[model samples]
Target: MELSFKGMTALVTGAAGGIGRATVGVLAGQGSRVWALDRVGLEQEGVEVLTGDLRGGVLLEEAIARAGRVDVAVLNAGICRPAELEQTTAANWDETIAVNLSAVFHHLQRLAGVMKKQRGGSIVITASTNSFDGEAGLIAYNASKAGLLGIVHTAANELGPYGVRVNAVCPGLIETPLTREAFDRPEVIQPYFAALPLGRGGQPEEVARAIAFLASDWASYVTGATLFVDGGQMAAKFGTWTEEKAEFAGGRWRLKPEP
Candidate 1:
């Protein structure tokens, strides 16, 4: 289906990052008047860049005000500080919760008001597959992501009455700069991807497409829902690919060629 954002206005946070950059391109290419927000300055050809930290509510308000009217808002800014429960510091926890969860709440609150007045809009949050699974060494990241579901549910319910829809996209092992190290280590991904039915990691563009769908008219009836952009990683329990039946090559697992 064609996802068109012709003449619409969109606001995207974390626009300097992988998924954020891809989302900006998708929305803008589809005809949306896109406003890209990030802590660092962005130099995209057609996007109106808003440089500021998401933790501060001021930048969010500024973007909303400048946009004049927001038809779609992508709450995508986040940081991942990996540490096991025993090793996770209070400082790390606070920072993660602040950026990943608290900031999202504030953004949603402001966007809800705008959309409510307009009587319509879509909000797509960048949640993660870690939101559901207890991945090791990511106590704070996992907690923050899980907390987003609560926000999605609550926001969708309250905003529905005002003709606003809220949803989330849960990506798994997307190849962004944040994850470049992991993607570089074949030893790390071989075992991890073996369990994934798709036998590979995802790309930022893939996740962006999912975000676009949720933010577009194509998902007119979808709200308070989460679309997993994982490569079937969440579906397998005992693992899908095996050394005997598949080979780990070119950074991913692939089935053996048929004779």
Candidate 2:
């Protein structure tokens, strides 16, 4: 089936950055009237750009009010402060939740009001693989992402009858501005290559495509689902057994016949 957003109106948050910027491009290219929201401004053909902080919620509400109707809402603004559980301060936790989970809730609450009355819409959130797996020094980030699942499932069930679908895209090791510096370091990037079954990092457009599909009529029957755009990272938990067998030296299960 051809995926098209012809004549649709899509509001995308965090549009200045990696995944969000790509999503704005995808939606616009697909013929949607796009509103790109971020702290920084963006300029592109067929897209209306808005700048504001997601934490305050005023900008989001204003955008919705101004648009009058929203066909698709992509909640992609989030922050990650790497602090271990014990080291995680209250401020750290609050900021992460405010931008990631709470902002999503507020946006959806507003969008649902419009969509329910209009009787149809799609909402896609940019969750993360960290939603399922815990990483050291990312307590708040992981928790907030995990919380998005609850919002997705509950919102889906409540809005399903109204033809409003809510879903999330969980990205893993995507090449984005946020990850560029770390990805540039071989010490940081090599481990992921070994763990991911696809043996490579994903691009923003890859995740954006999934988000676009979920936000389109193509996923009409799909709801409360979390799609992983992780290059098989989530499915490659046991990959180390084969890819790094040399680490098992002196064990019965060596890479070659025991001598």
Q: Per-candidate TM vs. native?
A: 0.98, 0.91
Stretches of candidate 1 off by over 4 Å are: none
Clashing pairs in 2: none
Clashes of each: 0, 0
Let me know the TM-score candidate 2 reaches against the reference structure.
Answer: 0.91
The C-alpha RMSD in Å for every predicted model, in order, reads: 0.9, 5.0
lDDT of 2 by residue, 1-259 (tens): 7899998889999999999999999999999999889998888887888898977778887888788789999999887888989999999999999999998998889889999999999999999999999889999999999999999999999999999999999999888888888777766766656676666678999999999999998898899999999978888856643533433322112344454
C-alpha local distance difference test of each model: 0.94, 0.87
- The candidate that wins on lDDT is 1
lDDT, candidate 1, 116-149, per-residue tens: 9999999999999999999899999999999999
Residue 135, model 1, lDDT? 88
**Cα deviation of 30 in candidate 1 (Å)?**
0.5
